[model samples]
Target: MSSLSTEHKLPEIIIPEDYNYLAFFISLNCNLKCHYCINLNDKNSARKDMAKHHMDGSDWAKAINRLNIGRDDLPVTLQGGEPTLHKDFYRIVNETDDSIKLDLLTNMAFDPEVFIRNVPVKKFTREAKYAAIRVSYHPGYNDIDELIKKTLRMADAGFYVGIYSVLVPENKEHIDDVMARCKGLGIDFRVKEYLGFDGEKWHGEYKYMDAISQHERKSCLCKTTELIAGPTGHVFRCHSDLYANRTPIGHILDPDFRIEQIFRPCDWYGFCNPCDIKVKTNRFQIFGHTSVEIKDIHELN
Candidate 1:
């Protein structure tokens, strides 16, 4: 079927009533594994087994290509365990239409020369104030000095690069030290509030703690403004669905697929992923947007 005809046949993906940002997981395959990674929040081995497989680079590029993100808001975000790890990373980046504003989440572990040789500055940048290239700083796996150097090199190459480190309980002081060092070196460094459990306890900044605890469930209406694509073409409602290997709502390649902005019922309210359940601000920096919602949950045993 022709692209235009397919689009016409497909239900127009209605952006949620107050949709703001779209986050696409180019691949869940990351090189550096943080101990406190939220992806492991749902420890159900059975659920993890059900996760979707990775999609091909061409298909990924094609799927992302169909998105209709408007100006200033930025287009789909290309992220993963490490998007650069994908065999067709460069191709996907270069293949995407020029109109879409691209953002990257990386570990900055790739060869800068390769990045500089093939990708232009405009490919991964926008007029937005925040740096486009968000490099995660895992103190355990990455060297801060090297991170600073690499980011500086990217900055020098005209890439809007920055560093983001999760504030894990054990590494707060080290993180502070790294922040000071990066600041002195003129590299963009920021911290993400840690999310998930670490054996003895739970940590994060959410009021609806039990909503995600899984020990108890409270149903509430949930909707998402972000577009989450697993390694495969399967699109998920929120991080929980993606990480828990829940079935996807639709695939970009399928002509029948279109985004729905409605609050769909989710039975696994207790299994919410921190990324989705967390009450964080939206793209416009407005607070109070929960990706998933439950209408009627039982608190009884």
Candidate 2:
């Protein structure tokens, strides 16, 4: 792990005026291993070994604080195999600029009392349809009862919290039961569309079928509206590249880093991650939006 000096002022990374999402994978390490983990969805073996250097909380704050988001609707999302697993998770959140809103995606594996004591509620508070602190409830991997207790505890403490779960085909029955229970308790419970294969058929609503087909590699020009940074502060073209540990477009700590909105060349089009190509809701809950766009696709010889 590395830390940034407080005296150094890194160059501003101006987020494109049209950019929709900004994500920082603080640490890819997690406490649970779900069978349907999206980070390991790639056909390649690169994701199996995700042992990479991570930026400490101070450095992460320094790198993130350099961003000029210029929008109130979009918050800097802190996610990971589990973001709370980062040693300085609280420090990173508290040290970030007050002007920047923050969002957290986690599995709720931490102590809620410790979180409430360390985190400021205002930092994660925002006017949105969903909660700012979004917790994923993996049916078999995590306990829904414990999650409900933690969520209610946080909510009572003035934090906006919501619970989400993927609608895995086999787990649908249990998920539905949990959703009803949560709704009865006045907790925000939502279901996400299951992506990837389910033993027999491919699942998910994707714009480009061939992108997630995993059949053959193809050449194409890809562009993204999201600013995705890995644990090492390296910005990737898309989630597919981020999880696969592929080459990065630039490092966040680089003094000259800037957001470039253009179509870049790609050779692994068929092995795309579902999060990039899935037809899902945008920040405004508008449907039919995809994170990355691919064009000029052709068979690779």
Candidate No. with top lDDT: 2
Q: Which stretches of candidate 1 lie over 4 Å from their true place?
A: 1-17, 41-52, 217-221, 299-301
Please give, for residues 1-301, the per-residue lDDT of candidate 2 as tens digits. 5433446788788888778899998888888888898775445566545534678888899988999888889999999989999889999999999899999999998999999999888999988888899999998889988999999999999999999999998898888888899989999999999998877888999999889887899999999999999988888999989888898998888787798889999999998999999999999898989998899999886
The digit string of per-residue lDDT tens for model 1 on 61-124 reads: 6666676664556556788667887788888888887877888888887988899998999998
User: RMSD per prediction, one decimal?
Assistant: 3.5, 1.7
- Root-mean-square deviation of candidate 2: 1.7
Highest-TM-score candidate: 2
* Model 2: how far residue 148 lies from native, Å: 0.4
The Cα local distance difference test for each model comes to 0.73, 0.89
